[model samples]
Target chain A: MARRKGVESSIALADAVAMCKVDAISAYPITPQTHIVEHLSEWVNDGELDAEFIPVESEHSAMSAALGTSAVGARTFTATSSQGLALMHEILFIAPAMRLPVVMAVANRSLSGPISIWNDHSDIMAERDIGWIQIFAENGQECFDLTPACFKIAEDKRVILPTILNFDGFIVSHMIEPIEYWEQETFDKFLPEFEPQIRLDVKNPSTMGAVGVPEIYYEARMAQHMALVNSKPVIKEVFAEVSQITGREYKVVESYNMEKAEVALVMMGSLTETAMTAVNNLKAKGIEVGIVRPRLWRPFPTEEFLEVLGDISVIGCVDRAYTFGAASHPVASEVKSVLYTSDKRPQVREYVMGIGGRDVRIEEIEDMFMQLIEVKNTGKDFPIQYIGVRE
Target chain B: MEHLNVFASKLVPGRELFSPGHKACQGCAPALALRYLLKAAGPNTVVANATGCMEIISSAYPDIAWGVPWIHVAFENAAAVASGVESGIKVLQRKGKLAPGKVNVVAIGGDGGTFDIGLQALSGMLERGHDVLYLCYDNEAYMNTGIQRSSGTPMFASTTTSPAGEKVPGQSTGKKDLAAIAAAHNVSYVATANTSYPFDFMAKVDKAFSTSGSKLIHIFAPCPTGWRCQPSDIIKLGRLASQTGLFPLYEYQDGKYTMSEDLPFLKPIEKYLKLQGRYRHLSKEQIEIIQENINQRYEWLQKLSRVSQED
Candidate 1:
């Protein structure tokens, strides 16, 4: 192995692109995500990766450039966060609507409030409706592993919507971890040459984006929507294929030893690792605990989530983001809806934590588990719990 | 609109590419420019629109005004998106999947979207030599945002952002020479068209679409609201704007210039500016100053008529 060294999330992303020898990257320099591009530019400068690094002025330009490059039969990637993602907010709808399987890494951060720079889920939360398949990772290891997988999932012939592999800023992005690195030949077999069904060409001379009058507008939009919902099955297939090749089992909604468990903790992003630590510690003391961590945020993985929480009485749905006076937290609201039709729906306990880079401790998570068990045992309800707040 | 089929009286047969019920004022010149553009480019072309009034109008919820494959990306990336579509087609053609030479990619935008916000992406597309025709329907202001001044706003033309007041006259700077900028890129073709003369405008649009490398057209699209004129006066303003030599119709192809319409004699500048509230504040001296500048620019253009002796 090439000397074991720790890499930042941004550095790890650049290294993945470098090591994989990705062909194209359309990037706009937004803070937090700029480090990855900086390292990528260096890689290109040193002749390490043969790629077209388009330095765009805005996030919208970045997505547009990526769309163009990908349409031209080139594998493409990009990175942005918060305002950049919001600015890209418009094209975010177009990329997947056009079904361009472009892989982007979103450095998840809080959307502007008082304008904070640290980690939260506000940005990607805002993009929830843009039709891009979203995946959140817990650490650098997941970030590294899921990047190539992102390209695979988005490029799947059945599911051509753009895919985003999100890792919280400074949480998993700046941290380092060990990774079982795979080789290029392995990927070559894993993802064969990108044979896109739809592409732009002079020879064929078919227009990709044409104005549709009212007569057909709804049909076109409905077609794009159906294509996205159709991506659910394809996502499962890609996960299976990746696990077979890498020998690391993956799921849209994955369970961490949740079987026969009374109370299951449900969450997303890197906080799951902290929750896992809490789960293990409590289980050692004869507490029945488990975690249902969501990797796929978009397409919600309703079936898999139902399976993961099967027969469980209570779910501690921890959302690291706040929706500001919705029914509850964004994730909490969605989890409640997904469990709407189930016969064995759990009594969901919504807990809000890890906002604005608030440190998520093992003890805090253990306390959440303890609270959920009681919520199940007593049939008593409490308002949304806020953990680790200073008075 | 200029009757291009003057002698034959043949109507351009097709469903409308730019339809009615847009949020635009009664008669915006870009609205007409799009009509002529669709006529020339034909129904076979795809339009990549930047996020602007045009996009908003044609793609509003539950209704679309376009008859062809159209897409609207963000404000400044229409050219890049067209490049993507063009490149996609190129790959499709190479793979023997897409039929060759049947479809055209056209990017349409206002002056704000084209001359300012989309400059970089447009420049990049021209540089990359994509087979895309970028159309700038120059209405002089960002009309979609309530008639604000853009980079293409004409000198002394009052706009919401460039208001004429005690301290400042409207739009203190001259209109940016966008066609020359495109020409500087050594693009295959670049042209200046006026909505007042639809024949000349459509001719340039046809030539642009027929060109292989990137071609750009800057159309002088008059806005009734922005110009503070009667809605019906749009066509008249467009024509008067050209007849006064304010927006001379011409084309640049193969590094040669051809003034599309001969201007042996032209109307005075006041004939063009007198109808618009934006220019209502201009004094005799200011109007004279604008006339002097227009004459000088046209005379300079006359010098480049490739066949001065032949003409």
Candidate 2:
């Protein structure tokens, strides 16, 4: 039996992780990501979780220690945000290249310069091509459910790659939400005991993370790339299994009322929930506006996205992070590239909004849909717009 | 010391954990030190190696020289990685996933990694009191990257980065006292060994592995290529370093200090310095300064040992 309880989203995520029976956890404290590790440490101290919680010195050590635990065939986890993620940039690539299935959660916050600690996608956008299975959560429930699912997907022998679960900082991490916590028996059956394919063992001594000479470096990287590309089906299969156990379905690309609509709004993370409400308001005004959210950001869900696009003529791609001097923002550029060879390509307009904790109200989301409708009706080209920017 | 009755080969284990056929430079003292280290640790061990000459030579993808479990994560995190390996094994053993027994977790790094870049992680692991043995092969500089000057490079020793030029004689700063730093952490064991003294080095390795808590052994490995010395003089230089009181052999255990071997009279520093091309440019005044520094350091060690004896 699963019991519904009102708790902070970070607590819910920590509780969910405890249910997975992780062997080791290494984390450093960063704002918006602290509560998750704090709760885990409490659980470990209380003897409720049978694991080692290493309070590492820095985010760099946090990830490096995770590599040690995971390489030794232990289920390892860590969490961070913003500057912490940037500090861990070096080990992030090595985790995937070594095929160590470590799970991490990122409370997506803006990077420093102005040094703001708030909800945004700037942190994760910088790590777009690090070769991890990146997933986005729309709300607290999704964050809780994805915890075990990520562990399961990562530990699967077919897909021996680390996974990153991203949710908006402060906005989703700090919110109190009603989450259905799992019972011990149900949780145990969902995620099986981790049995690693390669591990550090005395009886079967082996070498790992060897120096890749030029003769083998290319093939080694190619094998890692192909493994990630081949993990899509495994991800989908695990999601289906999770849906069966939790009775809540999950999709790589989720659409809301996109059928027979002329225009759509595209995005990710918690903003999708706000976009759903905005879509309902547009429906009341006799405007057919739909929303398309890609839950799986990596291995980019091209087929599912194209299937949902159908005959829609225009889409407003709302990105929370800027790509600086590039043609468009990160999410919008990805959308455009995915639609390049499609038979019925939609007019994708780039919109950068809610940067560095700037508020994006319901009216702002409604306005984005309205802009897309105008783009459809007038057939006019417009430059990338930065919403909520003052002149 | 009395002469041993038996040959050295008949005393230790016959099996070699660190096999031969690696791409190390001829007479590489670090490689020899590692061979002796693995022999002391036996087979039930896991090594977390930092990126350096040893990792590159031993593990080149298709070939590996280690007969024991080894991992190389990156530079500057060997101690942190070893911490993870130790903790992982502990938790798993408690959970009945692994057999209950002694499994040595060792981290190996070079002078550049230990005395400089990897110092913070080493300090963290020691302060946290992890059950690990951190072995530092002090070749004195970043020999893997063509002899750049590191903090472990002795004063007035010339490296590529600290070249002896018209204005600068050699390395300007004194060598960082890594053993003292490790002792400052209040770890259970801290020792310094030389490759030429294999029995002393292996004895320290055995003590470090047998005892609990964080332990560190700083091995003085002579780098012929980096130090611009004859490869054949590797062992002779190591011996001279100790005889000259430049690199003393000592251990700090359980709040007490003990010298491995006490010399009645110190050899002149010139005997050690004159053999190396890097020190050939040193003036008589520079040699005096270096000798004075070494004498002061050796006296400090003797004072600490005398205090322990008095107590």
Candidate 3:
């Protein structure tokens, strides 16, 4: 049982992992993500948590160790940031393909090139298609709440896939907030004990992660894709169940002040809260603007996203990462693809705002809304643009 | 005693862990070596294999050849995975959830997966003192990927990536000494064996399973296709290579070095080199250079063995 109180979001995240009773944790130190693992190690050493803390050499080994631990039917957890997450790239694909159901937290940071250790979405964005259930947290409370939910959803029999939670590096990961912690009874009822479908048991032996030749490779990949896509409902149900236990509600796509609003902003991560504040400021000035943020990124809430943008005339997407030389950015590109074939498509404008930890304040978000309103009124959708750039 | 003999005749355990009718080439040395290894390890064992010829040939989707519970994650992670498995089992057993037994956790990899890309993970696994045995099946090159050269490739050996020509000879560098590297970790046991002698290889494997902490076995398994030798010469080549002072069979245990079989008189290196077509392009001068290198390495090993024995 956890005492409900104020704590650092990283500590809260580790506490939630402890409450859920993870059997193994493999980790290597990297910024912003180090606190979570450090707390886990302290818990293990202090005898607060009964788990194996595998202090590995690199993030690649971290993920690989998680794979092995999970393969043996043990509930496993790991955390990384920036290049650490990037280093675990190849092993990331194996966890889901083998149906290990390992839970990971990625403190979203920018990839290296003049190297900054601050917050951005570039690290997780580069791994968008690695086939894990990716979810974003907008604040410290969400970080605490979603850590357990990820384990529940991933370990569910119908959706035995790996899960990754992305919280902005140094923004929410380093922030302290009052969190509604869960007791053992609350967690146990909401998320039951994990029962692996297959394990390395001598009594009932089987082969896993075997060679998929050209004859069966396509079918194997198709099965994995279908499994990930089918996990959306499980994720929603787990979130609802967890929310019922602790009165903090969650949705796949959350909208703020969208009632009778004409223009809306679409974004993800901690910046969504800033955009919501911008919406509130605009609302006080009688400018009807709203914000929509998708908490679930991977099994991308296509239906819920389209339903949220139903009658809005102008929709502006604020992306924190760029896809160099691509026609569009990350979240905006997915948003465009979702609305491309729909009849209710709105005038979409994408603004690449926070690359390598560049600040995106309320004023910048308000300017983005102004640009979206102009694009809606004039019917001239501009090319993908950057905000706060020194021209 | 008669019933026991009948039971042993019918149910020879661990030999069936690696079944027949797989995709390995005819007279594959690694295959024979793995069979002997599993036979020594017994039935209560779990294995993790890196992506290579062994994984690819043994497990082709619905038609797997492994009888024991096994997994193959990716290349360059077998040691790390084995570490996790060993630690996980220990924790589970400590918590009284897992049934206690003599279950050995083993990681198997090819030369490329072991000596090159997988070295860091192996080093980490050893330094952490995980109770796992790592087996590196040294086939000299990346035979699964069509004879490409890896860090384990011998000097002056022709490979697809290191072809011999007028300007350049085959491989420019010598094989990385992985046994010494494993020894540097101060592990419990480290040994080098060849597939030709099943008794020697199995003896080392038995010792590894009995010892507690990290143990590694570097096996010299020749590739008939990659070496451009007759399939019948696989075992003969293994023996000849050992006899010619190229790949000595020895073990380092508890800071003590012991040779499985000491050489009374070292054979000429030409007897080993002339058996393979990959070394066919070597001139007289190159052969003499390789022979000199082998002699120096052999001398170093002998000195280390004497020093450790005296200590």
Candidate 4:
């Protein structure tokens, strides 16, 4: 039986992963992400989760070990945040390129400069081209639910690519919320046993991660890229199935109060909830504003994003990570590129916000909506605004 | 066990897990080490090879030399990968996914991968006590990338990066003691082997596979191309390396050190150095320095072995 309990989001996420019955977990300690692995270790020690909890020395080894486990046809998992994710930058590419279905939870945090341990998208933004199936969770419940969904999506025969489930560090991971946990029997029926197409087995010996000569290197990469691009349908099927089982609606690109709205705030992660508050406040007044959040960030859901745009003429594309001297931020750049061929090309103004765990107040989000409205009303171009930045 | 000889090949496994027709350099000792290692490990083994000579030569996509299941993830994480493979197998067996049986998980890397870049991962695997056998083929330098110096490169041994130039001799520092480092982790088994002594290396491999916890075998694999020596003299170079006490063959097991082959009187280091072009530029003084370093290390090993014997 599924039970609802008020628990820390990290604990709930750990419980969700345990429900999936992972064969191996290789993790290192880092703030915000530490609790998830800590809870997982506790479960393993308490005999609640029957899995190998490898206390890997570093994030590089963490991901490498995961590759080892996954290559051996085991359901493997790991977690990290910020610098730990940066440390895993090299292995991250290998996981997808080799088509190992390892699932990872990234407590979204800021990258180092002055060395801050706070929430941001800079860490993941740096890994935009890693080719993993990246997803964003809005809150605790989504983090819990998305854990199994990510594993299902990653381990799906059609899409044997690694997946990363990202949730805002501290904001979601450390926050206590009432999350409904799935029963093991229910989860088992939802996500079938991991039947790997290729594995490191002694009986059927084969080489993996072999040297790709120029003759086949380009083709191998293209095949991997196509697999990810074609995984959209498979991901949608899994999402639909998850929704059916849980009695909750899930979408690749979720829109809140976009109907009859002329302007909207576009972003990802827990900030979307704050943006929702701003949307509600604006709707109460005569001014119409909405929020467009892409739950599935990678393989960017272009068609669904286009459909959600509807008649919104201007959008404040909120990005927690600044691309430093680039024309626009990571999410904004993708939004612009995806809308390039589409006829309904909305004016996407880039808004860099809440970087290094700066509080993104509801008023600030409301101001972003107001700015989007201003951009819609006036036929003027505005420079990329760094929200909450002092002059 | 008495009939275990390289010349008398009947004693070893007939099935070559590392097959022929690979693009290894002529007289590549690491390749021979792989052949011998797979023979000892047999069919029930999974190898995690680091990016180096063996990986490039053995696995070039369409043509694969490895007859057993092999994975080459990156240059620096073979041990970590092997750790994962071992853990994965254990958990799978525990969950009834795989039949309960010993599947030897071996990590293979060159000196460049094992001594320097891959050291942390190797240390972590050993510290965590993963059931793995990490085999390092120490060919002195980065032989695959055209003879660049690595930490495993012997002192005063000329390499591309550590060129014996006007003001400086080749490779300023002595070779990093990787066997001692592995021993520091208190793993169940740690051994030093030379590819020239195929029987001894294969014997160590057998012991390593039988061990339950972390094990490391550091093999002295001479690179004829990198060393600029006669390709056929690889065996002689390897033998001289051990005979001259430049690279001693020993084992550390169950908190006891034992010499695999004890020499009554060590051969001159010059005899070993004279064969390889990498050491051709060394002056008598430089040779003396190299000789002194080898003497000190070998003496320390003999003392440790003596202490173990006394206990």
Question: What TM-score does structure 2 among the candidates reach?
Answer: 0.98
Q: Where does model 4 exceed 4 Å of error?
A: B1-7
True contacts kept of each: 0.29, 0.71, 0.71, 0.88
lDDT of 1 by residue, A182-257 (tens): 6767656666556678655433333345445677778988988888778888888888877776677878888886
DockQ of candidate 3? 0.76
Query: Model 3, A1-391: lDDT tens per residue?
Result: 4566888889999988998888999989999899999999999999988999999999999999998888888889999999999999999988888999999999999999878898999999999999999999988889888988999999999999999999999889898888878777777777787789899987778898898889999999999999999999998898887677667779888888888678898989999888888888888888888888999999999998888877998898888887998988998899999988777778888888888888888898888887887887888768877888999
The lDDT of each candidate is 0.80, 0.91, 0.90, 0.92
Best by DockQ: 4
Specify the CAPRI tier of model 3: medium
If scored against the real structure, what TM-score would every candidate get?
Answer: 0.77, 0.98, 0.97, 0.98
Question: lDDT score, residue A209, model 4?
Answer: 97
Between which residue pairs do clashes occur in model 3?
Answer: none
Residue-wise lDDT of candidate 2 within B189-267, one digit each (tens)?
9999999999899999999987899999999999999988999999999999999999999999989999988878789
Better of 2 and 3 by TM-score: 2
**Model 1, TM vs. native:** 0.77
Candidate 3, residues B1-311, lDDT tens digits: the string is: 68966775554453567889989998789988778788888778899999899998999988888878898999999999998888788877777768888788999999999999999999999999999999999999999999999999999999999999788899999999998899999999999999998778888898998999999999999999899999999989999989998999999998988887888878889978899999999999999999999899988888889898995
Residue pairs with backbone overlap in model 4 = none
Kindly give the stretch of ten consecutive residues in candidate 4 chain B with the minimal lDDT sum. B1-10
Residue ranges of candidate 3 with Cα displaced over 4 Å: A1-3, B1-14
Where is model 4 chain A poorest over a 10-residue stretch in terms of lDDT? A241-250
Candidate 2: the clashing residue pairs are none
User: Which lDDT value does model 3 have at A123?
Assistant: 93
